[model samples]
Target: MSQQRIGDRYELVEELSHGGMGDVWRGYDAVLDRPVAVKLVRQQSVTSPELAEEFAKRFRREARITARIQHSGVPQVYDAVLDDSLERLFLVMELVDGVPLSAYLRNGRPLPVAWAAAVVAQVATVLSYAHDVPAIHRDLKPGNILVARDGTVKVLDFGIAAILRTDVTKLTATGTPIGTYQYMAPEQVRGGRITPQTDLYALGCVLHELLSGRLLFTADSEYAIMFQHVNAAPQPLRELRADVPPPLEELVLHLLRKAPEARPADVQEVYERLRPYLPPPGSEPAPNEAGPDGVPDPTGLFRNPYAPRSRARAEQRPPAGEGQPAAQPVPAPVPGALREEIKEAYAHADALLDEERFAQAAEVLGGVVERAARALGPESRQVLELRTHRAAIQLLGGDYRSALPEFDSLADAYGRTAGPGSEQARACRAQAARCRAELGQVTEALAALEDLLALVRSVDGDVSEEAVELRRDIGMLLLAQGRTIESRHILEPLYDDLCVVFGPDDELTVEIAEALALIRLGLDASSP
Candidate 1:
């Protein structure tokens, strides 16, 4: 199919997947220049025009409610658009990079108990916020759950079920349930009311499958599955896997209770029950608890809740400041074989980086940096260069907290070895400021950038590329903080310098000019 543009902003690139309700596309937001997931709702075959109009209204309302979920686990809903025809509806959402939980059930191999608990606990946390919105998922299954590379769980298609289940009939024309039958609750199968408890039942199914490596019920047909959901007792998890924790199995049974009220009071209670199995804060998973191959550890979030990226080396270095000791002398040169090994490591890292495998590339360099640092003192030019490269890779991978301190240390090391005025030291300091900016330390970032800019100007003058970039950064940072007058002052001088250095037609010159123009307009509007 030809690529289609929705709402004049989201341009479909390729179809990612299709479900009963709609087709999800890997898309791009033209205005923002960012990737987005565009879900196009299938035009349902309604009997009358009024029904179609009502469906459109419900779709918009549901999309808006889903956007209010306000949890990191939910892919942010950016926009909902319906054409005047009422046949075409689209939802633009944050493009999540993750592997669906379905991918984790490799060859029916059971997941680690802690891994399963971690996934469920995170899901419960998301459900708590969603239930507070009183937004029942109606369909919670492994297919809709994503384990991000950073070990965070993301729940997808939050309100799509409600939008599609506008009618009372539980089964579609194909004789399949509205949601996946394997994970449907008894009420959902019987066309009864759906409450937050419905989601708990589904979560129970997911947990059971995660631990047992099999569905709660398997049958010859979708009808049989639905019948089992409404009538049959779920097989105890311990029956399928002896290693299953008794309390966890009990909690699953509690969630799978035939009646909604028979289940745990709320998602909070379910989370509390699962908490005993969750990794404690700042704890690391045991070697035996490693998850399936190529799958990120879902337990990492619980293990180090809100923790910063870990430094490759265990020891912390002293902070860079006045009266710091002089740089250590460089060690003897490395043997030819080791030098070649270092070259190969760099080559491999670069190849990984070219493929956008940033985390792996960072890891590859990290493995070699320490060995190289030991051979050539930590302050040696070669070691500093290696550290700088790995730090840049970390920053690109969005590990700002990890990159920040490395940049700070590199700056100090470079200052001591190559002199404070050296280009290397200034660049490292500037990078540290950028990391601070990314980490939301705006005040600290601005202070650091301003100080570095002064130092850059003292060495290279106002028109130097480094000085020009620093001025632009400071101006943009001020503009972002709503300090329009201050931003204008910084940009006004920078614009003049840009025009003199690179001419008015240069891209940098035009950018600064445009920013100045916008600032002037805002200032004029706010004037008394």
Candidate 2:
């Protein structure tokens, strides 16, 4: 859609960017003689009288919303209006100068910690005010951050993201999953509630990346990257970049914890934590000192997270953050063509899955499963085993009945590939048994488990902590089948094992104790 002139005052310049919903353009205000950004709403994000009306209101109100924010970091809103046919709407905002933070980071150099902290402080200050005004950015990332020539950092995109909290859901029919996934907090990813800490967590990742010049987590694809953010423990920044101070290392990792409960409650805390890191004014060297290699820390500013780095926890430093000289960077293009080959198979396999040709997806993924199994060798816990996990998801969709037998075969294969006693194999076996149980083949499920358990017991390999709970599975199944005597016998031994493995105060033992008490009470009170 052509940018419609706003109120006969602003002339749309040229399209700057496009998203799922709309196009953004630079515009000139005839009266004010200043440049402004106008975002025209896409027709697809609107439908029906009610939606159109709400879209119109939100579109017009964006100017008012951005106007309410009083901060140097936030862009000033000039106007929001509907165009000639009333089918199109646009927002006019201060045209921020300079490239986005995403482009800045792509220059392939570790950003100095002090510079990163300075930038983050501005963000936290911006967020603190916005949240206090009962507004949140919802989407905050390097892409939305604008860095000007004078080192001024400005945050863009407030109005549209603000309405996304409620208005995005109202457009459910045609809504694409909004926001960049890499920066999404765990709660935001799950569609659960979000709080101020969510933004702070993302800031932690940004800071880690700025200091280390490496992604905090990475995978073969974007979705895998998101999955890691949501599930995996981030490798500590200190481990990834030895120059990271131990205290700051622990702090960033703490902020990036999978649970929001682990982060600082608000931006005030972020600001306070970052304040000291900013080099005292005027003492800093020339800007060209900002080389791609990162500002040299002759004294090793963040050599460790514990050092007397911040006055707050200097006493806790492990001998004043002194550590061995920084570890060399991992040379890239890591060899081992076998892994790359499997990756290529899985990438094509995932593409087929997205194209909805499950049969083809299964075939490619099957090859991946086989090759990865061989490359990882027998009884390996290497992550390549997750290929089977991905393959199983497609199998569960419409092909459950046929998939059931394949699942059984895969379980046996996994038994050999991951070793029957290993967590990966046991997880596969349990999933297979679950499918059978769901199909009302409980007897088959029990028999399969018994066979797996006997085989596992015969193996002379490491038993995962999961093995401790397998006995409980057997006991629970027996108890449900009117085999009270046998169930109690199994439960008694499992109860003893739990006590030995997990002290009485442990969470798992508490669960086992409760189950055992129920059986004991049942036997004492009545024969049944």
Candidate 3:
């Protein structure tokens, strides 16, 4: 155990630090030719036979979970193993060379709001990714975040990681606490169920400290900090850092909500609401993450709040002649019992949304959508689609932008329901690209059209009329983007095919003919 290599490859160079549960070391991985920080469980946390088994399982769990997650701002895990004597366990992780965020914040000058937000955004993305796989970092603080020399920020510690795998030994157990109390969520402080939102609350504390160059919350004792977390609100950020953006001020406050439900539903919403205010996605936004009362609505604009939504967006009817599903005729003698049930479910789901009870609505509407899709058939425009207020609710609940992916998915779904050439199919494809473009995913927007072409080719065999029309749409976008060569190649063949298939008088034939004529005019006009 004295200055030695453990589990073969890692050569322990020096003891780095120690805490209640383990000792940490600076080590060399000769095989990987890199320095790594190895954490070894203290004999105390691993002494019991049953605890040893649990400790091994948990250590491996952290390693396995972290190994799958790749983020530039996270320390990567290399290996996890038990020492031969079984008195110790260790994990090898990337060695980070940087100051802890707390050290960086200690500078006389407070961090720029944008840089602080950027660091938080990076961590939020990491948390979001972990949350997606149902993992929670469980421990988050300024000290746990490494600020590298190159301005890169890396979030460390999954030692107390909780993966929602459901076998139940997941929650970090101590009678009254786990993570640093000042950053603990009310639920975690209260010893209740913890969700990804708990990690978000801890981030809020970190953000507050960095921007103000001070602690957001503090108590003389751990018990006092835990008590404060359960029933307190950190002083508003702007109060400490007067120059803090008004919107981010709102975000920090919202995150510090004593009630978890009052906070942004996930780390994503927290970041996305603030992301728009930042430039380049990694920078800060102008005017900050603000709201209607002029506070930050990092609940984000789409996330509905806890209060009853007094006004809902009036449903936008599908464009005329688009996917405008024809209203079903009330069949004569329809049973009151079945009609009542359908009316009941739809109303209840809407009620849940109006009350900002999204999870409840998801539970209710999920059943409604599932049964409706099954009964109506997946292709039915009238099926259990995420149309109506549900999409808005999903966005409001911060499940990410609900409207974009739904449009793409439903566009694909509609392609199957109505033939690809049908107006419904085209409208869905167009809507998805519009969202992609609006969301700043230009390359992804282009891919949406490519998908449309794929659907067209699949539905309309090669040499078919629909395939030629799909090519025209693709050509139009390419031409607009200055990709005239590829555009012309696709359009010229289409025009040649249409000239024979429908003659010059046909609408599609004339369209392609006009496009080709314009292309030739441009080429000829540009000639010397």
TM-score of each: 0.63, 0.51, 0.50
Q: Given candidate 1, what's the lDDT at residue 9? A: 75
For residues 324-414, could you state the per-residue lDDT of candidate 1 as single tens digits?
3465575668868768877887897797677676655666677678888777767776778888999999899788988988998888788
**lDDT, candidate 1, at 171:** 46
Number of colliding residue pairs in each model = 0, 8, 8
lDDT string, candidate 3, 1-528, tens digits: 124888877778678777644677888664654568998755444557786677667667767887767776678888887776666678788888766666665554556665667678767877877787666777788767776644456787775434212222212434434566667787876566778788888988888876777777677977676777776657887777778878889998888887778889888789877775444522233565331231122222123323343442333434323443334433244246534655676687676567565644544544456555555455554442434335445445544344666655665555455544565656566555655555556575677567656666676764565456457767877777778778898898887777787788999888878888888888888899
* Candidate 3 Cα misplacement greater than 4 A, ranges: 19-21, 43-47, 107-109, 161-176, 276-528
Q: Write the per-residue lDDT of candidate 2 for residues 1-528, one digit (tens) a residue.
A: 123467787767577988755688877665654557887766555557787777677766655767798997787877777775658777778887666777657765777666677677777778888788766676788877876644567887775664544434211223434556677777766666767777777888788877777767777866676667788888787776776667778778878988888787778877787767766633554463363432223212222323432321111211111233223323233238766765776676566556565654454555455555565543344333544545475555445554565555555555444444455555666666656666667796787666656655565321335455456677777877768788888777766766776677788778778877887788888964
- Pairs of residues at least 3 apart in sequence or in different chains that clash in candidate 2: 245-302, 245-304, 245-305, 246-304, 246-305, 247-305, 247-306, 306-317
Score residue 259 of candidate 2 by CA lDDT. Answer: 85
Provide the lowest-lDDT 10-residue window in model 2.
312-321
Candidate 3: global Cα-lDDT? 0.65
Q: Per lDDT, what order, best first?
A: 1, 3, 2
How much lDDT does each candidate structure score? 0.85, 0.64, 0.65
RMSD of each: 11.7, 29.1, 24.6
TM-score of 3: 0.50
